[model samples]
Target: MTAKTLFEKIWDAHVVAAESTDTPAILYVDLHLVHEVTSPQAFTELRERGLKLRRPERMLATLDHSTPTLPTAANGERPYANDEAKAQVAQLESNCREFGVALHGWDSADRGIVHVIGPELGVTQPGMTIVCGDSHTSTHGAFGALAFGIGTTEVGHVMATQCLLQRRPKTLAIHVDGQLPQGVGAKDLILHIIGQIGVDGGTGHVIEYRGPAIAALSMEQRMTVCNMSIEAGARAGLIAPDETTFAWLQGRPQAPQGAAWDAAVARWRRLPTDAGARFDREVRIDATAVKPTVTYGTHPGMAIAMDAPVPPARNAQEKRALEYMQSQPGQPMQGMPVDVVFIGSCTNSRLSDLREAANVLRGRRVASRVRMLVVPGSEAVRRDAEREGLHQVFTAAGAEWRVPGCSMCIAMNGDLAQPGQLVVSTSNRNFEGRQGKGARTVLASPATAAASAVAGSIADPRDYLVEVAA
Candidate 1:
């Protein structure tokens, strides 16, 4: 076997010994976050088996995927009127209560998207193993943890044993060099990389994001980068813990306290790859070459610079994706008309993202022909943005500022794009019908989305940003 990379070392450390080559390996899971969509079936399985959660204290449950932005304003009103959704949330609450797992539900100030709540609450620390039922659980990897999504069955496995059987994945070091140009954000950078690597280039591997450009991103930006690792066909994405990670951890509820904090930081400082560590694969990207980007086809990788013409469908896969997206090649992404603009999701719904969108939209009105929506990733983010008047900016721009949840990103709830409607979105993933059936979605940065919302068409933020700065 080759000398292990940091990801492999971390994985081996978490392994509680293997069962068999085909059977599951018992790998300790430091944190388990349960959400409504994936927990119901797992809970059902547990009830059927007469098994309780092995260690409830290590698990946290919340309702997000199925919760609506509105709850009836009456006595005993539930936020979700869908009976199945209500049951899922109710079951999760019951499971957590009966098994003593902590829960943050609709009324709880701590409630939000599981991925969003974990890091904000300090439950996702560096050098930890975190798993959730949601695929974007990789978002927590921003803290330098081995975080990834699991299936419902695997969710049960984690609940029953606080361990999972996972195959050791190859490691790919994605070295992003140089500083990102002005107006380019993490979303743009990841999109640019995906465009270069193709969506499935990192299959069967875990990606370690490294180098000056990757290290320069803020915690939220790092989350945005790692959140889309799965789109690149990586099992997970990680960054080595550093001062930026520690600064974000301090003072949070689950973060270490007093001297414990100092000790934890000291340990985190040592989490980087040791000298001479080896990776199975490597890719390099120049951040300075990346510009504002948008997806023109169904896949995230089928993207180009905002000002560039759409690429021709050169192959079978490209042709299929292009046909599904109904996009013509060689057409400029900019000035492409849109019907809806969405700014939220686990990928780019943090407070800073909201602030950036707000800064771009301030004193500007969204086009009357376009409908815009802003959904905060979590309740805490929603509250903070409102306190800072970010909501006001969105609303003033004729955008609907909804409550916290993964609205429109996965379409689990009522928020979805209408058929044939083109949407300019900040959320990751623009795959076929990702927003809704026949609804075209173009992934862009928050600034780009804001600019598009105002212009009623795809437009670069640099165009408006320069004028505003001037």
Candidate 2:
């Protein structure tokens, strides 16, 4: 028998029907994640067609995007961005009730950003096929799941029949050797990867991040890496299940228990790519060379080491990105003034991420000229951070500690950057107007974001880390 890649193994198992050159394969979906913003339209389609969800138990819904990160008013009314946002939430509740789907409502302690809550609840597991309307759904791929985002129409299709028609994406293996320097982490690693390969380099492929460096990363760090695979144009990102993966899922609310867990781990252990399995393509990176990195332009690919000068654009599109960002080819990023610093998103809002940022902010103060917001990824993360007194650190440092939600990541919520402001954000994308109209976004890791908040500029996180250690 031929050795099979991890993706091939999962894809083959979930295929209800094989694909041909001109036809797509019918693949079974193990989980469907729903959020208020994109799910209403999909549910509407289901209602119009008189269709009920085929597998309600396999779905989990939450309210995120467009939900204000701020708490309710004194009158106890949620300060939704607008009536449409409020309506979307209500519509989701109605649809979930009508379809018999489970929803983590605002009052639920489990409610959070869809991607964050999925793994937190242990609903995302190895070898499972997961889909959601939001692109960052690939975050679940950190656990070896075959996860990807879908469109509203496809969401409706999955609701009607717990299956999807998909063409298998070719596999791209990214191998990283050596150790990442202190203060540089998963977010920087991914940004560096995107910089090396253009934003579209992973087009038409699924990326499997492997090697010693990848294996050394924690589960949350791996999630941060996979969460941005979409920005690389990959259908999904995956890491084979290992001891670390199993350990993270062992006792979660939805994870299997007792003998069942043993059996599940046994199964997952077999899911890694078979030795000598061939990939369609491969890219190798020396992790030692990676540094605290940040995006200087309007896209994820236009990034450089935090200590390095911005590179010159090679094309018209590149020039436009620089112009939009108000950046020049030889400009130094280190001391560029930052108007705001936001550290939260599915990509890097986990507890560990908050702790890392807090480490940099402890006994420090946000610059008088800079405003900073730190939003947790979920209710659980918020609770955990408060328990650890991380929130106190943030607030003491003069940063706003926000409620759990997508927050400024989507910019549709009440949390947004003012026009013409320069933002150092921990979110995945730095696209034009992503945070607000005329806002310039610089993508960085949590540590870097916190450091920038202190320095009022794009500063190296290592400076703060060294001080913290001392």
Candidate 3:
């Protein structure tokens, strides 16, 4: 038998029909996660075609992109961003009910971001193929699952038949060599990778992150890294399953139990790449060389170390990004005034991320001119943080404690930055107007966002880490 890469192992196992040069392969989908933003149209397609869902038991739904992060009003209303947002939520509810799919609706304590709750409930596992209508679905690949985003048409197709036609993507091996320096994390490491490879570096490839540095990260941190693979133009990202993966999944609500758990682990242990498995391409980085990084332009790839100045634009597109960001070549990102700071997103909204931010803001206060928001990725995360007094740490530091929702990350949930305001955000994307019309977004990690909130500038998290230690 030929040695197989982790990706090939999973892909081959899930292939219902093999791929040919002219046609795509028919692949089985293990899980289909649904959300309000993208599923309504897909559901409409299904209804129009009179197609009953093929596997309702394999589907999970949630309302996040359009749900309000602020608390309900005195009237017990949800405070939806708009009537359309409310309608989208309602339609999803209707669709899920009609299709007999389980939904984590507003009344459910489990309600949260689709990506966040999937793993929280242990539904995401090794060697499974998962798809969602959202691009950040790559986050699920952290569990060694073959996960990727699908379009509305694909969503409908998957609902009608629990399979998808997929063209094979070349595998790219990203090897991180050394331990990350203090104050730098998975978010910074991914940003550095995008900087090195450019935005389209992983086009037509599924990246497999491996190395001692990757092995050193916690499960949540690995998820954080995988979540942003879409921003690099990758079809998906994966990390081989290990003891760390099993430990995180063990005893979770939906995880296998007793002998089943033991058997699952035994099978998962075989999912990693074989010794001689070959990748289409490989890139290596020294994790120690990566610094706490931030994006200054309109794309995730336009990033630099927090201590460095903006680099000269290499092309017309880069120049346009700099102009839109109100920055000139050689302008320093550090100490640049920011009007807002956001410390939550699927990219970095887990308990570990909140704790990292809280450690920076524990004894500090947000700058008087800065507006800071700390939104959890899920209800469970919110409850856990409250139990740990993380919410109090944020609020006491002058940041608003928001409920679980996509919130400002999508800027469609009424939490948005004002025009021309510079926002240091922990969200994955930094595209212009992503947070709001004319809002300048600087993507950073949660700790970096917290530091920037307190400093009212694009400050280095290492400085705050020193203060936190002191």
Cα lDDT tens digits for candidate 2, 282-348: 9999999999999999889888997788898889988899888888788778888999999999998
lDDT values of the candidates?
0.88, 0.93, 0.93
Candidate 3 lDDT, 391-451, residue by residue in tens: 9999999999998999899999899999999999999999989999999999999989998
lDDT of 1 by residue, 104-124 (tens): 986699888888999999999
For model 1, name the residue pairs that clash.
25-165
Candidate 3 similarity to native, TM-score:
0.99
Give the Å shift of residue 301 in candidate 2: 0.6
Better lDDT candidate (1, 2): 2
TM-score for predicted model 1 compared with the true structure = 0.96
Q: Residue 51's C-alpha lDDT in candidate 3?
A: 88
Clashes of 2: 0
Query: Model 2 compared with the native: what TM-score?
Result: 0.99
